[model samples]
Target: MFKYVYSLVFCIILGISPSFSQHTEEHAAATTAGHEEEKFDIGGMIMHHIADEHGWEFTHGVKLPLPIILYTADRGIEVFSSSRLDHGQVYNDYKNEHEHIVRVNADGTVNEAIHPMDFSITKNVATLMLGALLLILIFTSVSKGYVQNKGKAPKGIQSFLEPLIVYMRDEVVKPSIGKNYGKYFPYLLTLFFFIFINNLLGLLPGGANLTGNIAITLVLALITFLITNLSANKYYWKHILLPNTPKWMWVIMIPVEVVGVLMKPLSLMIRLFANITAGHIIMLSLFGLIFIFKSWAVAPAIGVFALFMSAIELLVAFLQAFIFTLLTSMYIGSAIEEHHAEEHH
Candidate 1:
């Protein structure tokens, strides 16, 4: 009787030991899996926001579409083509009641009743448009007020605007493009204010990447390129075709000079694109680190770094706009200078 009791007790202990060990192993595996899942979810969200269009739709049916300003020919000339404002898509019907639905697909599963994209304009373009409108309205009103005042000391809006106008005229326009600066003052002022406002606007959340879009920056650069070449006197062209060089080196040097002309605008396009894109990417990357760790322990540190970056981006916004405008004015100066008169003497 004693021997049988001992055997029974031994079997029970052995059986329960394996079950406990297995349970512990399973628990550890689940914890690791949860951590991994958390990391992947965070990385994916950050990548989606920072990366270019991937055809993803929102559950609320709001999608931000890239604005197409104009199409271009193979040689980069503007091709006039008409595009539909709403692209023939309807979001909702007010007259008749209809159910709003959307569909989502994930990992072989389908989620139905997902809302479609919102057809309304996005915030980015709206912000840029608003900025432009505000500048125009304020400046126009101030100009009218100044004219009405008949050369008396300025007040109110004019008082604030006069200093900026004078600064651009003396510091930027006069110093860069000399005597003939009056002809280009309107364009220079418009360009400076437009870029400055847009750059500042992009710092706001949900703002569109006005300068980050290479196509938009390319158009602006092209304008500067056209203005420079068109404004160039005979002396400017002579230098390009027949530079002050040894007779034998003309063959190599002329082609190099021509290439440099093309490269100048290309540099402008790259500078704005790279600077804006880099700031956004760095911010997103820092935020991504929080999810990768799968703990609140690291979030505060990441947030601090992100805040620091945001501050730097704010300064970059103004600096980039100013530098671009300054360089453009300098280019115009070289083209329209009194080179011919100097050579003739």
Candidate 2:
């Protein structure tokens, strides 16, 4: 278990690179070079880390350039390193304007005619891939541990993850998803751990806010929505279309039920995105206070509060993941519920 913990820490430390490298490093470079005595803008700093970008800002001025893949009407498809546009430099008539790659003409003017379809791997996308890789590595080792110690007491990584797996399987998924939980356990488990891992990663210094991004949350919600509706029994639809209410009230109940169906996933997406993003914004804002007041006196107070907030955010990270998985199972359980169960009720 100790060795496994060390491995996890190493992988995370390796992956927690700053996002949107171009802008963040450019500003840092300018500040270091004494080119301009610019006023400290906390909003920009917060956004620089929160938003997606082409290059990986590995550490201060040192960027690990990612590949830029774009498709344009004229160019068909162009592939190159993001370093070409580092520090606001334009290469081959393309510019990275706040991480948006746009075509520029000879006079350095933006070309309106050509709209490039960006297929580049951004910061969040990279983090998602990293998390996926980590998950694969983690479970692979755990599987080995289980096999090596089959029927014996769990040890190492298996011992660490087995409890989490068992807890989710029995306490959360089984109860929320009913008897049909076996089939959906894989998905629910994966979703929970994925979000939980990304949430924890986003809390680290210079970590990309993968889970905080709406695009990522929206995908998770949509998957749940699709699974819930597709597996829904006739009774589930019947309850929506023809509720227990009177025929006269069907008009109100039907539309309301339809909206309710859509709202479930919408609420899931917003809740996770808002909570993760808000936590990040608050943390960054607290750090910004030092620059805001231009005094070292406030550091101790802010540090104490930041420490407290970090603890809260840690709990929230797991809570949000658990809530998402639990709610998804409940929705599935509702959709597949037997008519006999309703009759019993």
Candidate 3:
């Protein structure tokens, strides 16, 4: 178990080491640059670290600039490296403002009138892509292992993920969705691994807060919304439209039921977004204490607490994934459940 944990951590480092190295290098530069020590802004650092950006700082004075694709009315489209706008520099009559690309006027201000469509792959997007690719690679290898060891015991990554797969299927999804669980198992499994992996990545030293981002959470919730409603049996809609309430109360009950329908997905969105974002914010804030105090002594205490929080966050990563999958299964079950009207007694 400890070996597995160590291996997971090692893979995480290999996945994010380049970006982490440069983030540390950035902080290093900020502290040791030129003259007197500057006052550390804990809030700013936390926000900056958590927020998505344009380029990957792979190392000291090095970056893997992602493509910056923009489309405008006059100019159909343009693609270029984000490096062109590094260090507040201008590129092709445009500048990056807080990771946003916009037209620059000749007078050196943003041309607000010109709204260009940005289709660039930001930091979070890149992280999502990387996470997805990693999942593909992992599951692919596991699939191959299954074939190679047909009658033998599971080996390597296959062994590692088998228990998790079985647990989710047998314990969570099966129980939650009952007989129809198999149909949705694939999606739920994919969702679980995607969120779980990304959450773990976000907890890493320089990982992008991909799962913490509201946009990502919102999209996931919307997907759940679609799946729940689209596959819903007549009983589900009937419950919302014609609840077991007095006829006189239909006016109030109907509106409330309608709102509840929308709130399902809304709650999912806010819960995941708020929880993950809050965790990142708290973790970053805790670590910022060391620099804020400007003392070597602060490191030990903060480090211990940060370690504790790291463990909590690690649990949270898995917990959040489970909660999401469990809730989704429940929602799906509720929608498709066979409802028999109460017999008059």
Candidate 3 lDDT tens digits, 41-143: 6766667777888986533465678999999999989999999998889888989988888999988899989998999998898999988777777777777
lDDT of 2 by residue, 1-345 (tens): 112211133234433322323233323435565676456778888887788789877546777788999998777989999999998899989999999999999999999998899999877888889888887888778778977998999997777777788888899888887898888888888888888888878877657788889999999999999999999999999999999888999999999999999999999999999999998888878877887787879999998998888778877878999899999999999999889655556
Evaluation by TM-score, superior candidate among 2 and 3: 2
Kindly report which residue stretches of model 1 are placed more than 4 angstroms away from their true locations once superposed: 1-38, 41-47, 50-128, 148-150, 340-345
Worst ten in a row by lDDT for model 1: 1-10
lDDT per model vs. reference: 0.59, 0.81, 0.78
RMSD of each: 21.3, 4.5, 4.8
lDDT of 2: 0.81
lDDT (10s digit) by residue, model 1, range 159-256:
76677778777998889999898877777777766776666555555445567768768988999999999989987888989998897999999999
Residue-level error in angstroms, candidate 1, position 256: 1.3
Q: Clash number for every model?
A: 6, 0, 0
Better of 1 and 3 by TM-score: 3
Q: Give lDDT: candidate 3, residue 253.
A: 93
Error of 2 at 335 (Å): 0.9
The residue ranges of model 2 lying beyond 4 angstroms of the native Cα positions read 1-37, 340-345
Best by lDDT: 2
